[model samples]
Target: MELDPKALALFKEGYDKIIEGIKTLGFDVTDENFADTAARAAKGLHELIHDQTQVRKDVDALLAKTFPAKYTEMVISKHNTCFGVCPHHLLPVIYRISMAYIPTEKVLGLSKLSRLARLIARGPRLQEDLTHELADLLHVNLASQGSAVYIEGLHMCMAARGVGAHEARLVTSGVRGVFLELATREEFIKLVVAPPTTLV
Candidate 1:
């Protein structure tokens, strides 16, 4: 969507004030290119906080293909990495997501699974919310007997502020349908915790 001219002017004003604020703090920003640089910075910030169209389009495309399930076995996609912006601080959070589903009637394209995960991770979101949203998406879209999502993230908000525990990692999960069963849940967890393969 095109931004309103009035709104753009207001945003430019805000950026100008930010430049002035830095000047008051003893940083010189009188260079000729400074205004252009500040404008770009402001535009980038606006996009990061407000833009969702591209990611939405990506998700729609990802869900475009489906086929009938031919087997009763589980399908797992593991250790997919993506990034999200934290709602509270607007800082970036790096995510490693693992997902699984047992197909009932329909199945989704395998590559699109990761694409969906990445799309959901694009905007300002909580890790817990991200996990459940992915699981729910699969449960509904695939008409699966079960679905699960596990997420591990390194949040810049926590590490860059507050008590600043640099080594901290956050983990969250969501499970639905048959995945709620103890045996099935345990099986998924075991696969997630297994050692990674190494190439010779």
Candidate 2:
């Protein structure tokens, strides 16, 4: 298959390091297995570190929509799951996102919210950056009066290493515009925290 010259070069460098690193760890990287093992390791690392700019653009084109002169109301989406690589350890961080917005002249389809969340969470990322970026994207792209995002993440970097408490989770939130209002913000918070029957 055709490949980018620069990327191929970088992959080779990484692949070489993988073989050497394993050999240094007291395991014999034999000639027979060396090529295959390095190729696999390099491919995995490239996938984890690849740029996601195109993915973001494609998701925006697929999802973002605007309509003329619409009434304003709170829009909320909950339980959107995100599987991302933690930049620090290259481990998975599982995220559940809940978001709310008040539309100005635009609103996104319900399914698109989940798509957007998924697209943004795919590469090496920090939960805080992911939450802030999602909120910002919604606020601008939806032309909304306000936007709020809440994220709860189980970081494998934390769970699998360091203190190693698997049950520990990190929660983060971001809000802009009318969501800054005490009551408006609380309304969004309550919706996420309350059971489905409360809203139904």
Instruction: Show the lowest summed lDDT stretch of 10 residues, model 1.
Output: 1-10
Over 1-200, each residue of candidate 1 has an lDDT whose tens digit, in order, gives 34445545666788888899988999778877685866676565554444467566666767668888888788999889888789888778888899999998878888889878877887688899999989988898677898999888999988787585877889898999999999999999889867567758
Candidate 2 ranges with C-alpha deviation above 4 Å = 1-16, 27-37, 41-50, 67-71, 194-200
lDDT of 2 by residue, 79-126 (tens): 787778888887778888998889887777778888788878877888
Model 2 lDDT, full chain set: 0.79
Clashes of each: 0, 0
Q: For all the candidates, what are their Cα RMSDs to the real structure?
A: 3.4, 4.0
lDDT of each: 0.81, 0.79
Error at 53, model 2, angstroms: 3.1
Runs in model 1 lying further than 4 Å from the true structure? 1-20, 30-36, 39-50, 195-200
Query: What's the TM-score of each model vs. the native?
Result: 0.80, 0.78
